[model samples]
Each structure stands twice: as structure tokens, then as C-alpha cells.
Target: MAQLLRQLERICGDDHVVTHPHALRTYESDGLLQYHVTPRIAVLPGTADEVREVVVACHGAGVPWVARGAGSGLSGGALPVEEGVLIVLTRLHRLLEVDLANQRVVVEPGVTNVAVSHAVAPTHFFPPDPSSQIVCSIGGNVAENSGGAHCFKYGFTTNYVTGLEVVLPDGGVVELGGKAVDLPGYDLVGAFVGSEGTLGVATKIVLRVIPRPEAVRTLVAFFDHTSEAGQTVSDIVGAGLVPGALEMMGRLSIEAAEGAVHAGYPPDAGAALIVELDGSGAECDARFDEVVSLCEQGGATGVRIAADDAERELIWKARKAAFAAIGRISPPARGARADRRALA
Candidate 1:
């Protein structure tokens, strides 16, 4: 262990290699707090070259190693291995390139999900917006194939990721795909995106970004029953109205979110649906009105359309905060989500 630690220190500076028990405890677990394992050491590699070198050193020493990003993942993929090397990638944070002409951006694995949208805001936006986007790293998203509130319309992380610079388990570096669409080859990129760090470590990622919508309409529908909210979603999809985002929160979920952020949720609601539509101004307006009618027909107790962007953001805040807020009411745990149809 001492020898491998020295090798890691040489690869990434002494300041970057952590060995103190207390410091290593920080990497013991990710958002999956139910499981924990204190790694023997954790290395912060500053660049792709450093990451490759650290991995190579561990490979040479035959020591097990795990890759980690922001440590915000709840899937337990980032749980440290006891007596093994912990390769922390947060130091690799960087926005490498922005090709507006190609509608793509290249970023290091450590870059936060929301940071990408902020980097390309106003004119463009990244679609997948997990609740933890502010802190979760792109590498973790690639590992977990995470979906966000907007995934119903825009798709998951796999849909936007066009290319990856990955360091294989044996410490060999490779490029899986390019910016081009549908290259004639095995779908290696697809297999790697959700491998949960078993296949390799993503050093760099190429992501597709879309033009910002001309207009967006948001609504929060309070329901007397969860079944009605589910039926509303089903009806919206059945009507060929693909909303940009459709989110549902049950009674307990709503109470937790409202208590946590006071986002103005209806106090007596049994369930709530936050539906958003985006695209051309006229299209969004028309579809949004139709969606309101669907909610009413589905037996919505009350319906509130966001008057402006400010109100829309507040609605999203409540939905996004709902996950963490649940911890206040119960033991902190990342609950499993069933298929959207399960509500119905």
C-alpha cells in the first residue's frame, strides 16, 4: 500500500494524494449513504494525462481502484473500495470546448451538469437536468445514465453524449465515438455510458446541446387523487402533446417539498403535477392551453399556470427540491422510482 501510495503521489502531486484517515473518510460513500467503505487512499488527478498515469500505476501494482466524480451519485456506483485506490476526478473540472456551429460542447468528466447549460445559456441549453445538476459531475451522469425532470421529452444522458475519451480498466486510453451521428460501428459508446465505471473512466465528454426554446409555459395542477394526476399525464401523451417536462409528486412528496422550500404548493393537495412545455411561442401557448384543459378534465382540484419565468422557476424548484426534502420526513435515502405508468 505504501509503495502504491508513493506511485500515486508521484503521478498526481503529493498535495493531491490523500492518505489521512479523516480525509479519506470524505470519499467513503456517495449519496448512497446506506453503504460505506473507507478507501485506503484517494487521488485527485488534475488532467486526463494524470488520470491515465494514476490508473496505470494502480494497474501495475495490481491494486483495485474505483473512479469517482462529484460524489453526488445515489446509485452506490461511487462507493469507495476498502484498501483500494479511489481515483477522484473532481480536479479534472474544465469546459474544454464550445462549437456553436456544431451545436456541441466538450467538457471534462468533472464538470457539473448545470455548468454545461450555464456555459451555453440564452442561445442554447442542455436538456438533461437532474435535480442534483448543480453538484453532480458529468462523469457520474455517464456512469449512471441519469435522467432528469426533462428526460421525458429530451431524453437521458445517453441521448446527448456523442463521444467520450475513456481510460479503459487496463489503463489504456481510447476514443469511442465522434461528433458525427450514426457512425458505422459497434455501439461501444452506448454500452459505456451506463456501465457505472466498470468499463472505464470517462476523461472527456462531447455533449449535444439544443437551441433554447422561443417560449416556455409551465403549470402546476393540484389533484384530489394521484390516479387523476397519472391519468392527466397519460392523456397529455395520448393527445400527442409532448411536454418538455412532466413531474408528479404524491401527498408526502408534496408536503416535504413545501416544507423544505415553501415553494407555494397547495396545502391540501393529494398530488401535484408540474408540467412544462417548450418550443415556438405559438406552439407552446396552444399546447399549454390544451394541457390545462386535460388537467381539468382529469379532475384536477386546482390548476395554476405560471404567470412568468419567475413563477415557473419556483415550481421547478419545488419539484427538484422534493427528493432531498424527503429526508426531513424520513431517513435520508434515495428511493427507487417506478415506471411513470405506475402512477396510473
Candidate 2:
């Protein structure tokens, strides 16, 4: 173990290698705090080559290791393995390339999910958008195949990921896929994605982006019961209207979000749906009307359309904050995993 630590330190400077118990405690678990295991050591690699070196050293030492991104995973995917090396990849963050012509962006593993969209916001956007987008790393999303509210329309991480520069378990490095749409042979890139880090560590990623929609409309509909809202969702789809997003919140979730962000949802409503539609202005306007009619038919007690971008932002703010807002209603101890799952 001592020799392994020395080798890791040699690969990524001593300052980057962590061994202090106090510092190691922070990495014991990820967002899923229920499972915790303090790793024997943690190393922050600054570059892909450095990561390879560290991995090579660990492989030679016969030491197990795990790669961690922003540690925002809710499933303990980033939980440290006891006595193993935790390879912290945050230091590798860098937007390596942006090809507007190909609508592709190349980024390091540690880049936050939102940063990708922000980088190309003027012309294009990467659209997976998990709830934790603001803080979750792209690498973690790739590991979990994370999908957010908009994933109902834009698809998940696997849909956007085009290529990967991966460091294998045995310290060998390989490239899979690329800027092109199709690659010959096996779908290795697809397999590596959502493998939960069991395949290897992705050092760099190439992702597909799409041009911004011509128009966008957001509306909130309140129902007397959860079943009513579910029916409304079904009706909208049944009408062949593919909105960009359709998200539902039970009363508890509504109260939590309203308290956190004042999204202005009806207080007594049993359930609420945040519906978003986008595309050509004419098509969105026509479809949005049909959506409102369907919601009313499905027994919505009241319906409100976002009057402006600020209102739309606030509505989404509430949705994204729903999980953390649960604490406002429930006691800290009562905020169990089951309660969290309910919000999901």
C-alpha cells in the first residue's frame, strides 16, 4: 500500500495525492450518502496522461480503483471502494473543441453538464439536462445514462455521446467513435456509456449538439388528482403532440417546490404538470393550444401559461429544486431515501 501511494504521488504530484483521514472523509460517499466507504487513498489527476500513469501504477500494484467525477450521483455510483484508490477527475476539466459545422463538442470528463449547453447556447445546445445538471459532471451522466425532464423528447446521454477517449482497466488507452455519425464494427462507444465505470475511465468525450428551437412555450396545469394529471399526459401524447418536456409533480413535490422557488402553483392542487413545447413558431403556437385543450379535457382544475422567459425560468427553477426542497416540509431524519424516490 505504501509503495502504491508513492507511485500515485509520482504520477500526479504529492499535493494531488490525498492520504489524510480528514480529507479522505469527504470522498467516502457521493450524493447517495447512505453508503459510505473511505478509500485508502485519493489522487487528483490533472491530465489524461497523468490519469493513465496513475491507472498504470495501480494496475501494476494490483490495486483496485474507481474514477469519480463531480460526485453528484444519486445511486452511489461514485462511492469509494474501501482500500482502493479514488481517482478524482475534476482537475481534468477543459472544453477541448467545439465544431459548429458538425454540431459537436469535445470536452474533458470533469466538465459540468450545464457547461456544455452554455458553451454553444447561441447556436446549439446539448439536451440531456438531468435535474442535477448545474453540478453533475458529464462523465457521471455518461456513467449513469442520466435523463432529465427534457429527456422525454431529446433522449438521454447515450443519444448525444459520439465518442470517448478511455483509459482501460489495465492502463491501456483507446479511442472509440468520433465526429462521424456511424462507426464500423462493434458499438463500443454505446457499451462504454452507462457502464457505470466498470468498463474504464473516459478521459475525453465528443458529444452531438443540436441547433436551438425556433420557438418555446411553457405551461403549468393543475389537476384535482394525480391520476388526472397522468391522463392529461397520456392525452397529449395520444394527440400526437410531442412536446419538448412533460413533467408531473405530486402535492408533496408541489408544496416543496412552491416553498423553495415560489413557482406559483395552486396550493390545494393534488398534482401539477409542467409542460414545454418547442419548434417552429407556427407549429408550437398551434400545438400549444391543443395541449391546453387536452389538459382541460383531462380534468385540469386550472391552467397557466408562462407569460415570459422569466416566468418559464422560475417554473423550471421550482422543478429542479424539488428534491432539495423536500427538507422544508419533512424533518431532517424523516428525509429518507424512500422520500427522495417519491419525488423522483
Writing each residue's lDDT as its tens digit, candidate 2 over 316-344 gives 88889988788699765433566687989
Model 2 accuracy (lDDT, Cα): 0.91
Pairs in steric clash, model 1: none
The TM-scores of all predictions, comma-separated, are: 0.94, 0.94
Clashes of each: 0, 0
| lDDT of predicted model 1 | 0.91
Looking at model 2, residue 11 earns an lDDT score of 82
> What TM-score would candidate 1 get against the native?
0.94
RMSD of each candidate?
6.2, 4.2
Clashes of 1: 0
